[model samples]
Target: MNVALIPFDTAAPSDGSGVRRALRRLPLRDVLQLAVVAKVEGTATLNDVSRELASERIGAELQRAGSPALRRRSLQILSVGCEGITTPGGWLIASLKAPAGRGFGLALGHARSAPVAMHDRATRKHIGSAATAVRAAMRRAGLDRKAVELVLIKSPIRLAGGGPHVGSTAASRGAAALGAALALGDIYESDLRDGSLCTDWRLHGFRAMAFSGTETDCCEALVMGNRRGGDPLLRVERAVLSDILDAAPLAALAAGAKAIFFKAGIGRSGAVRGARTTVLTSELPPDKQLRAAASGVVGAILGTTRAFISGGAEHQAPPGACLAAVIRAAD
Candidate 1:
């Protein structure tokens, strides 16, 4: 297996030049999945035009490369937003795999779900759609439930006249996480319903990291893990942060990591380990605050600000906690 991370700088809002440059380095086939984590100038309060254009450019470039994994099977994601210390760049990730291997290697599979209607944004329908897609990706990756390490989801938030649904983003993320959990056997289908989203803090996918955006109308899932006959050069490890201030586990995981992905949440209590937090009350959006503050903590541990950090974790982790994963060279 071969995994590639191509980073590029974007100079303007909704710029595709950087993404084009990055895609030029990728080939047309054998790619299990592709994902992008970009820094946006606009916060979630407004519709980010750049993010939409950048996502379109990525799809166009992939089509030009003759890759058949566009809207059908490839898990393509465009996560836009960079607050505080987050850098104004993005990483283009691609994973290629083969059939022969003696030891464990990174295995990847991707699939796109049906387009979700606005009314189904946080409903059981959304969860079912995501679960189906996740299972499909897992099959393609040749990994069973236990072999899967991470399920990175890019889900759509409810849109009203091209605008975001006030508080629907978290609900969408929660639905995505529950879907992943159902597919991975972490939770049963019976555990989920329309009312479970955002309110069922106890239900979550420990390995799931969901991000909601307006750039997509459907759900895309990237299933990653170590397969017995997969690539041996790289391995992935995941840990849960008790809270935003929980940095010790991250420090231990970054020893030789080549890439890191973090999903931050303000927790259900809107506090940090029982301390009152003004994140929910401040004028700034809560997502921005969590992303910025978590970026600082993770950056300090990894000694680099280039890590892929996103907010609005939902059911990806425990409320008020964070989820982190690292890809490092295998010993």
Candidate 2:
């Protein structure tokens, strides 16, 4: 994959209009010259990206840009990379994945689904729409159905009465997973129809990791897998979980990969291995809380605090369970 390293200074005036206007004025030749610099990138000062976005009422825009980049890019980092004592600036690094055994495969594709219905009902409609995006990514990566190993999808959530409705996110995630299952052949298309989403917990994509977010209007996915004669610089691996407490398999997978990602099912009873989880009892949304808890657990287990944990378990693995995976560099 080719990476473009543009040192963007995030310290711009309100609405970023000044920088936006300056960019518009750049001559075509100079802009083309800047395109030659590629590979890895570093940071620039983002004195107040958050404040600026808030002042402009473009939080959704910020969220939109961030979520899609994360969905499509193999590695997207926006970091200050320092302890809190004195750091005020940061970097924005976005890496694109290429096709045909060149680098890690990541595809940004979108799909639309019916919105407004409550819970699993809406997701039944999401099933068909989400499949389109999944296939698009698979095609871009030049991977046959069998070659695809992991699917990371952020499904679009539906707002009720123009506001947040409980379990709406779950609905979208269920639809997205069902869609992935169809594409990956984990479940036959004939096995699905109305009322098949969350109800049919038995149906799911063994390799798909799906989540629903309020930031997107459509489905976006990242497909990672093995390519024969692919670049040896990286490797992909996965493991299913018997329970949230089950860490043996994840540890084993970690032994073989350089970086790992985990997806844990929040049990219906709101507990991990029978000990109640605070996520269910707190006012915090389950998804957000799940992210923190799961990350903490996996990070502690692996002795690496930078773990990526997507929160959801609707048919992602066995009943009330989930999976773990790792991305390793070739030795």
Model 2, span 1-331: residue lDDT tens: 3222222223322233322333333332212111110011112122324332322322233333344332222222121111111112222212233354544432222233334243433455567667777787776555778887787766655655343324365666787888888888888888986767667777877788776654445666666666753445566678888877787887777664544567767777787777876766787656555555666667667776444465667877876676887766555
| RMSD (Å) of each candidate, 1 decimal | 2.8, 8.9
Which is the leading candidate under TM-score? 1
The worst-scoring run of ten residues by lDDT in candidate 1 lies at 66-75
**What Cα-based lDDT does every candidate model obtain?**
0.77, 0.53
Please give the lDDT score at residue 216 for candidate 1. Answer: 77
Lowest summed lDDT window (length 10), candidate 2? 32-41
1-331 per-residue lDDT for model 1 (tens digits): 6667678777665566787788778764666566665665555654567677666665676676555554243445656677777776677667765566578877777888889888777778889988988998898778999999888887887765343334477877888999999999999978776578777788888899987887778888988898887668888788988887888889878877877888888766687767888989989878888888888998888888777788888888777788989877888
TM-score of each model, in listed order:
0.90, 0.65
Best prediction by lDDT: 1
How far residue 152's Cα lies from its native spot in candidate 2, in Å, is 1.0
